[model samples]
Target: MNSLRLAAGAGPSGRALIELREVWKTYRMGKVEVHALRGVSLAVAEHEFLAVMGPSGSGKSTLMHLMGCLDLPTRGTILFDGADISSLKGSELAEIRGRQIGFVFQTFNLVHTLTALENVELPMIFQGAPRASRRARAVELLERVGLSDRLQHRPNELSGGEQQRVAIARALANDPKIVLCDEPTGNLDSAAGMRVLESLRDLNEEGRTVILVTHDAEAAGYARRRVQMRDGRMVEAAEEALR
Candidate 1:
């Protein structure tokens, strides 16, 4: 609702929309260490649709969490619009993440009792946006995702596809620079999954950077490019995006 300011020319050579330079995520379980990600570097251009594919325990989700700013790398730097995120702490990182990024989880993380409109408005409300604007933006995003008629329906009142749509709408409510989705269509039927993929593709065409993580090949096919990971390392899908 705040007039989505999707970044343009997202890359280092131009102006990286998102950059992870030599990223690593190592977690220690007592004396044993678990390395989820290892020295991964990636750059995504503005509006690029990238599908992150990997088997379970392959660190796709960990990498996604780092990109979403939900977690920090143990030994690397992630830059969002040229800002070094690894240097920020607690409240600072939270503010930037809330203001700049949107996340869509595999599970439809919607309030069961709240109306679709209310659920969609949650992020804007968190961002300290006015109540009226939150309502208006939520409505606009629901419409964008073809859920205009279901605005008054609660999560249980909607189908799985519909609930995911609301979740997607909520992700876009704040007009974030990047929309990060983890297994967005994993819980939907094939037809419903297709519908969701279409919506994501449409959003990407509308100039929003979409970074989706999926293990399904059919799901990843919707993206413009695909990046595969194995043993916590990138498999060299293609050249880094520039400009």
Candidate 2:
């Protein structure tokens, strides 16, 4: 594993942490076929804060899924830390997802029956972390997200922002190198959305590779790099000029 680096800009310079080479993803529905990603090639440097923006059916979500290992590309190669994962089996991919990738979605997917702390602890539990370590780490993560006071609250009892914070904490449980967020603030009001964005920024600052998928320009502005997609293809891409 590479030693992680933290910075205010696009993070420390290193080998490509994520690389996609001519990737394509297609789906078949009845007699029709849908192409979600079309020959996409890209790379994300270690600790980069990348925003993937596209309209509906533009394939940004599919790109995110491919990068996060939730789904494999239909054709082409995907390398994570230089390891080709595009051809991995389901169990192999699941291991990668647990150890190297974290995911956040618009829907706060915290288990309704689990308290915030418990929810944050779930991933570590899956990783076979001991109970004491899991509890301690969960508390630390909740505090990192400014949700220490809401630890015992279930999803139904907390505000949307609080619940999202819990979800973020849960995603960080496995200490993944990459954090994939898909319209993470689409369900929140402006205030809550800002809080979530700030948390993601903080995570990026702390050396996590943050790949955000969203349609909102304001949300995309938080990232140091932006890639625009349309009709299943990348139309434009840019990185912030360093000061």
Candidate 3:
């Protein structure tokens, strides 16, 4: 693996956009409780590309869910843009997620019949974005992610990499401040995976906060920083990121 910083540091802009303080997540699984996250604290700066690594049983997905506002932590504070979000209700959290965050999932999650342009425009349609503006923005994002030629193509008409790129374009439809991706390239072959990574790297370089969750070191290499987790706790490595 490359010598990526294993902690938070500077970015395209010197501002911290996401902060997790003493974050904890507990799951109630029958009589036994599961500690999915164990008091983890970290800062992800604006426009930074961060990779999270852990084994299957590790709390990587749990952390990503909390970070993406898909789930609330059982204990601790999550501050997005300097506001505490761990206490927000589901609706409030949804609004925050819709307005400020973008998600790229392992599954492309595209509507089978929707064209790439329509799939990308769904977010805005839900958010009540103006028709003209949403259409223009979706096209722009598709182009930005190198999908201009495929805008009118449906997911079934595209390749795996193209599908993921369309998903990315859709995620960016709201012009989100940060993008949270989960095993984004895990479904593709090596060549396709490389294309997806390059797309993510390009997005990060162009000033979008990019965070990826993956078990693959090769995938993590695309990030400027990597965070390792194990058994619900962050296994601190020697300091690589400048404190």
Candidate 4:
């Protein structure tokens, strides 16, 4: 856990890449209503590695989804690079997500039928990138995540760690500046999870802003700062140097 560095006294970078202000999200499950977030405010600076830790049903995933542009806040504002995006329609948000943000999930979410390379190239394909260029970038990203040797393997053929590596590579396919991960290592063994965490740390060190949502302290150890959530609200924050 010593690898975790805290960004103490690090004020806002004059420009936060993501800013959430009094954001609240509510879900309707039949006649029941679920308040997933409660007046949560946060600011994520450029190239910062932040971990949001909370128990199940603590709204960690909802917060991640809001930051990733997968979902908008039910109330309040979300600003991306200072522009309000809280009310953007699905297509507009999708555009922002495709070009500006990347995502990794606990499930790895790889196309079981696609090879690692193809899975990594899917984002570029959606952006209409040239085939040759997409292939080269996908290869480069896979190698960056230490998955060069697994290029042709399908998700089913790879180990949990390998699949997660491929997912990381895919997240970088669009060259996004921000990466949002939700319980990324939740499904892996200790050794495998370490690999995933190291890969994420490398990405953060390379200037990509990474937001990790997880309940595991060991996994959160890879981050420089931590925000603890409880009952849909951020209750604690800390930053410490990695020494």
Candidate 5:
């Protein structure tokens, strides 16, 4: 396998929170093999905000999924905090993901029936946190994301941006050390998108390692370091890649 390594050295000086060494992800579809990632290697430092920018089908989302432990690579090594987790079972991966990583997506994946506060508290509830502590943390996270007034609102009752903010708050429910956001602002207007991006930046500032996968240049600009990807491989620079 050809190796494409991008050393993420420009961010905050600290141990790498996640590392992907010569990772490959392949899928089988009706006897045809699709290689989503091609021996890509990367390291994300603790508290760094790194953006992976590419157009559609560039394997950015696949990369994010592997980093987030949502899926395992077909080949190569993945390490979380210096421990190899690439070969872990699904339940073991879920345990680490729940405790240490959070995810935000293009579509706000909030439950329609759950109030904002309730949604934010859901992760903690699953983690078996006490009800009182979960509620308090939910309130604090909602307030932090400037959604204090919308705690009682359901998804249908809030704006797209508000819903996204709620998703962000919910991602923080377990106080995850790493936040993986995939096209977080894809569904909102400029103003609302800016707010969501600002919230992400604030999280990074507060010592959370944030990895954002986006095709928008403006969104990628919020990150401390940017890496461009193309055709399932990391590239150095291409102005048109984000277009």
Candidate 6:
């Protein structure tokens, strides 16, 4: 696989929007202490598209959680837009996450009872946006993701690709600067997955920072830069190991 070579913790733009310095995450399962991340350090730039590739149990999801502000690191520093977020309170972290970061998942976690439009509007509602404004933004976002015709369809009414597109639209509802996607194409067929990947590429071209975590190299190809994780540590390349 072709890859870009750059200094560690630096992006094309030379400005780090998110930085993880000597980060470590450990989980305790009663009798055993599991280390999910081992002194990992990474930097994501303002509009960079980065892919984190790893096998199962490599701690890729744990890294995403930390980057998305969903959880805190057990040891080390996390900086968001030049602000150290490791010490931020839960409420403060939530506020930053709601306003500045968005997330997409492999499961396409949409509200089963809500229409596509309603699902897209959920984030704005959380931010206390006016109904009219949120609705308008949702419409724009859905259209942006090429879901203009399926606004009224529920998750079950749409195909896996369509539902994933709705999830992408919802992720953009709050106009977040950073989007974290964890195995977004895991459940789709090749064609559908390509379409979803294209949408993500478009979003990145439009200037939103995107971080994708996937084990599939095809998915990683959509990113401008790629990093590998192994046994809780970041490795420059692990293709041979993967094979």
lDDT of each: 0.83, 0.86, 0.83, 0.87, 0.87, 0.89
TM-score on alpha carbons, each prediction = 0.90, 0.93, 0.89, 0.93, 0.93, 0.93
Better of 1 and 4 by TM-score: 4
The global Cα lDDT (0 to 1) of model 2 is: 0.86
Residues 1-243, candidate 2: write the lDDT tens digits. 011111112234757888887788999999899999888877888888999999988999899989988888889888988789966889898889998888898998888989999999988887899999999999999998999899999999999888888999999999999899999999999999999999999899999999999999999999988878898887776557541
C-alpha displacement of 234 in model 4, angstroms? 0.5
Show how many residue pairs clash in every candidate, following the order shown. 2, 0, 0, 1, 0, 0
Q: How far is 107's C-alpha from truth in model 5 (Å)?
A: 0.4
Which regions of candidate 6 fall more than 4 Å away from where they truly are?
1-9, 237-243
Better of 4 and 6 by lDDT: 6
Candidate 2 ranges with C-alpha deviation above 4 Å:
1-12
Q: Which segments of model 5 are wrong by more than 4 Å?
A: 1-5, 8-11, 237-243
TM-score of 4: 0.93
Q: Name the best candidate (by lDDT).
A: 6
Candidate 5: Cα lDDT at 102: 90
Give the per-residue lDDT of model 1 (tens digit) for 1-243: 110111222333345778887788999999999999987877777778888899888999999999988889999778887889877888987886777788888888898889999999888877899998789889898998888999999999999999999998988887887899999888999999999889888888888889999999889888877788887888746324431
Q: Which residue pairs collide in model 3, if any?
A: none
lDDT of 4 by residue, 39-83 (tens): 888888898899999999999999999999888888988898778
Model 4 spans with C-alpha error above 4 angstroms? 1-12, 241-243
Name the lDDT of candidate 1. 0.83
Between candidates 3 and 4, the one scoring higher on TM-score is: 4
lDDT of 4: 0.87
lDDT of 3 by residue, 1-243 (tens): 111232244344567788887788999899999998888777788978888888887988888988888988888888888788876788888887888898888888899899999999998998999999999999999998889999899899999989999998888889888899999988988898898889888788788889999999899888887878888877853224521
